[model samples]
Target: MLVVFDLLYREYCRARLAEMQKLLLLAGESAKPSKEGHGAADQSHDEKDSLQQRGWHAAD
Candidate 1:
């Protein structure tokens, strides 16, 4: 019984570790800066367009 419980606990820990590693990898990838020269400008333009389409107006 003890051995079975220990094995299950280890498996659970391994699964949790794998999930954390995946999350870290995704976070690292997202934190990387874009390689394209105009990426930021393009993203900003798209965001502004989306907001305007949703009836969001800039404050004067």
Candidate 2:
């Protein structure tokens, strides 16, 4: 039972990581043109602010 639980947990983690990677890739593609047309620094600042507002932190 313990071994089965471990395997299940690992599979769940792998699926979740894959989903996150896909989302990140999509976001990157969407942001490319905007980043190039605007300024890199401005885009970075906006991303940081948005993340902060959403309660995400580097320390996390």
TM-score of 2: 0.56
lDDT of 1 by residue, 1-60 (tens): 999999999999999999999999999999997767768788899899998877745543
The global Cα lDDT (0 to 1) of model 1 is 0.90
**Model 1's TM-score against the true structure:** 0.58
Task: List the candidates' TM-scores in order.
Answer: 0.58, 0.56
Question: What is the C-alpha local distance difference test score of candidate 2?
Answer: 0.88
Q: Model 2, residue 45: displacement in angstroms?
A: 15
* Candidate 2, backbone clash total: 0
Q: Which residue runs of candidate 1 sit more than 4 Å off their true CA positions?
A: 38-60
Best by TM-score: 1
| C-alpha local distance difference test of each model | 0.90, 0.88
Candidate 2 residues lying further than 4 Å off, grouped into runs, are 34-60
